[model samples]
Target: MTQNPPIRRALLPATALLAALALAGCSGGGSVRVAAPVTTGSTAEQCAALKAALPATLQGRKLRDTTPESANTAAWGNPAITLRCGVGTAAVLDPHSPAYDLNADIEESGGVCWVSEQTAGGGFRFTTVRQQATVELTLPAAYAGGQSPVGLLAGAVLKADPVVRDRPFACV
Candidate 1:
């Protein structure tokens, strides 16, 4: 029986491959980074909750009075507070239309509409109306008073209403 020469593998190529893998491990792998959980619930409840949960800094802060007058189209958050929703702007379904008129006084809009609330901090936030079954909610880290706004909002909503539904709201 003839014994074949012991197969010898190249060490340089193997070492290079190992080094590459180690470098990749040191860097970021193909792993996905999971963000904080987004809570979803009734649009109105959530809105009211967030509004009531606003920190002291934002509670009395007067935002630009740009809320719409239409009951259906208007925002439903704290009457005194305002967020930068950029309302009163005309909608543009087609920007390249031959009749495209930027000077039109008509008020048109798009996207999920809803009332906005001020964060515990100075930032203003709002919840998007759900065209479907669920609405996503991102809680701020702290209010202007350095407190979690989500918990406060949730508590307020719960206290105000005995039974709060996690369903979409007709506000939008």
Candidate 2:
């Protein structure tokens, strides 16, 4: 065995530290920054549960830790698909508003209900209309094909939060 010189040993530690710091950051997909979501205590608590339930990877992409990270939000992939919780639910599922997404498009699977739609720019926007807290998901246009993150998140929400289904007369 050969012993390294004194200078070489000191340089090795510095090199290792830099490598470790680099790995702690968001992957090459890039770190997506957004304002920290605002929520009431009850909603924050629900979001906390959802945050804990989020997987390290979704749609086969590594999770990206957002700037000003919070329990109310989550992200995955290079372009970064983000999920925001504690949103307000609709009073009624509308059919005419530009932001309106039909309940008819909602799909329930793995104990979670999802309403997903493609935007004009070709990206996808999805939201949970029937869960305890409204969780909104956004996927960039670059990632047009992949397994949906809906089921994975649904499982997590089911475990951490309450199941909520739309009612005929209740708020959407």
Candidate 3:
């Protein structure tokens, strides 16, 4: 009677185990969904024009330039207390950017500030680039002043509108 070789049997199981380990290691970890900044126009004047066109709820907000991490953590339509909670959860999802300043400034006044992305340095290394945008929001009004403006804006923006646009980028 013919019998299988021990070395061949060992190799098969070892190969399978190695393959499984490789697959597990390849999977990315701590992936969070983040919104990308947008460019509506050029120059501060154009910025003002763009701001004017945003939904009325966002009109009163300020304008500032900051990082992508800062972009997704602002308050959109409510007070600081609620905004703080939203920011905490939102930051976990958005990606961080070092190029732009992620700006937000009061356009008209009344506890409001418009936050978005501004064009800055370009070209970098990344496995893939993702495109995301801030959209409509519903905030709680009032925020603790100690927080950075960027964080405030991103969280506020998300709270203002939970829904937004998303895209992907592959840096070559």
Candidate 4:
């Protein structure tokens, strides 16, 4: 029976480890997983416009593809900052809800009103308030400490689905 020399055996394990790491890196760069929002009629049209208006890069992160692609979804970066248009208004926005706190929770950026919520994973989710159709943006925990990127999305939201004058909420 033939046996590998000590040096050859050592190199074999090192080579295997390098190959595994390379594969992992490649997988990480693949498409981001995002649940596309469902839109209909006018809302669908609005989302399409918003998708087109979304910046090619967000917070210095270049845009990346999303799985099961749809016109209402977009993503960027390895940790993935994701956006979904034409979503239903967040339940927390309701005045009657116990979690509602207009003064404390609402934030205004680029003339748009937003409400932010911390996710279980320590990330943050910001959603537009009082717009024709809600748009949600999520930032991974890696972004928890930096300046908010909600402002970066304001232009596209305003251009595609400006706030509805009749809606109850407004950025003050």
RMSD of each: 19.9, 5.4, 19.0, 4.7
**Candidate number that wins on TM-score, 1 or 2:** 2
Q: Report the error of model 4 at residue 132, Å.
A: 1.1
Q: Give me the candidate number with maximum TM-score.
A: 4
Tens digit of per-residue lDDT, candidate 3, span 1-172: 6557987787899999888888754642222223433333222233233233333334344333222433232223222111111121122124563332223221211222233222133211111112123232222223322323333334333333332224321112
lDDT of 1 by residue, 1-172 (tens): 7544442345667788899999866653322222222233543444344344434433333222222321111111233222211122212212565533444322111323333444466554444332221122222333334432333233333343333234323332
The lDDT of model 3 is 0.30
Looking at model 1, how many pairs of residues clash?
6
Q: Write out the backbone clash pairs for model 4.
A: none
- The worst-scoring run of ten residues by lDDT in candidate 3 lies at 122-131
Candidate 2, residues 60-144, lDDT tens digits: the string is: 7888777777888878877778888887654235555556634446777577766678868799877676666777888888877
lDDT of each: 0.33, 0.73, 0.30, 0.86
Ranking by lDDT: 4, 2, 1, 3
Please estimate how well model 2 matches the true structure, expressed as its whole-model Cα lDDT.
0.73
Q: After superposing candidate 2 on the true structure, give the runs of residues whose Cα lies further than 4 Å from its correct spot.
A: 1-30, 90-98, 101-104, 165-172
TM-scores, all models, native as reference: 0.22, 0.72, 0.20, 0.81
Deviation in Å, model 1, residue 168 alpha carbon: 2.3
